[model samples]
Target: MRFIIDVLLTGLAIFLAALILPDSAVSIAGFGWAILAGLIIGFVNATIGTVLRFFTFPLNLLTLGLISFIITVLMVQLTSYFMGSKFDVANFWWAAVFAIIVALIELLLNSIFGSKDRD
Candidate 1:
């Protein structure tokens, strides 16, 4: 049940990112690939992201929340790399924007479905 929810959330996030980032696209054949990519992304974020956030806590504090955006962009890029495709952004700025959009959509969905408290 949790896994299904996670996958759906990830797919939605990837879809939102696709919508917001001009260069990001998933082929129709890539839908399955995108879901797989999302699973790996979610796993990476849950594991490596947690570690990075922990180590960057002081920097995150100093930056007043900007660091989280950077971290998210990095994670998204990492996901693209791992998936063996180009999930392009115009630049860091666009990546940040896409990340923010995905985050917002995920937040709204999670809130509506009550999934935020699971972990």
Candidate 2:
């Protein structure tokens, strides 16, 4: 299904981001944990993330949509909190950066592989 594929892609993106970011930015026990955390992250993004974006529409407009990075940081931090030691993000800025990278990678992958949801 599309959801499962998204989870796997998210996991791969997170794993790749961990490699690019410094240890101080984000840390994971291993690939297994990263994949597990990725599923959680994806779920949070689908549920809470959607609501947050809707409610924060004003901020998004005021900030010219840059507030999205903050939303991503919150989502990533929430994933870290839920997963405990499996995932760790020491800095919110790092979470922001990680979120950006993950989003870009996922976007590229989705485009290259073809997405049914896209027109």
Candidate 3:
């Protein structure tokens, strides 16, 4: 149940981000593609991202956690890699734009739905 909710939130965030970003940010078929890309992004973020954050802890701290934004952009790029035609990002800067939009959308959704206790 919680997993499904999380996926839905990710999907909505991706859909909204695609809409809010510039024409060159990312190209997608539509909502369906957004949902699929979101799933890929979430998967990459959950798995590889955890290990990456752990290894880059020093940089993360040194940058006042700013490395997170770069990691988020990487997540988008990874999603684009796996998705091929379904999704396309212009470049690193565009990926950053998409990441920012996705983060904002996720924040808004999480606020509306409220956070689930980890424990």
Candidate 4:
């Protein structure tokens, strides 16, 4: 299904991002851990992340969407937390960088293989 493909793509992106970053910035146990991390990240984002974004909508608008980026950074940290020893981020700034890298990779992957109907 499309959802499965998306998750795999995100997992690949996360693994690639971790490899691209310095060892002190981000670490992953393996591709399997990266995939599990991606699933947890997606779940967290779909649930708690959505609520946070909704409540912070006003602040996000005022900040010209910077708040959204911050929220995304926090989501990356939260994902690391949920992943425990398998996936780790050194600090807030590093997590932000990791998030950016993962997002860019995901963007590139999705553009190449995403459903054609998506607008």
**lDDT, candidates in the order shown:** 0.69, 0.83, 0.83, 0.89
- Give candidate 3's root-mean-square deviation (CA, Å): 2.0
Q: How do all the candidates rank in terms of lDDT, highest first?
A: 4, 2, 3, 1
List the candidate 3 regions with Cα displacement exceeding 4 Å: none
Candidate 4: TM-score?
0.92
Higher-TM-score candidate of 3 and 4: 4
Give the poorly placed runs of model 2, Cα more than 4 Å off: 116-119
> Per-residue CA lDDT of candidate 2, range 27-118, in tens?
88887787898888878888998899999999999999887668868999999988887799887888888888888887888888778485
- Give the per-residue lDDT digits (tens) of candidate 4, residues 1-119: 77778878889999999999998889999998999999988888889889999999999999999988888888889999888889999999999889899989998998899752564
Stronger candidate by TM-score (1 vs 4): 4
The ten-residue window of minimal lDDT in model 4 covers 110-119
Q: What lDDT score goes with residue 3 in model 2?
A: 71
Regions more than 4 Å wrong, model 1: 24-29, 86-90
User: lDDT tens string, model 3, 1-119?
Assistant: 88778778888888878777766767887877888898888789889888899999999999998887788789889889889877989899999878887888888998888785431
Q: Spell out the clash pairs found in candidate 1.
A: none
Best by TM-score: 4
Q: What global local distance difference test value does model 1 have?
A: 0.69
Ranking by TM-score: 4, 3, 2, 1
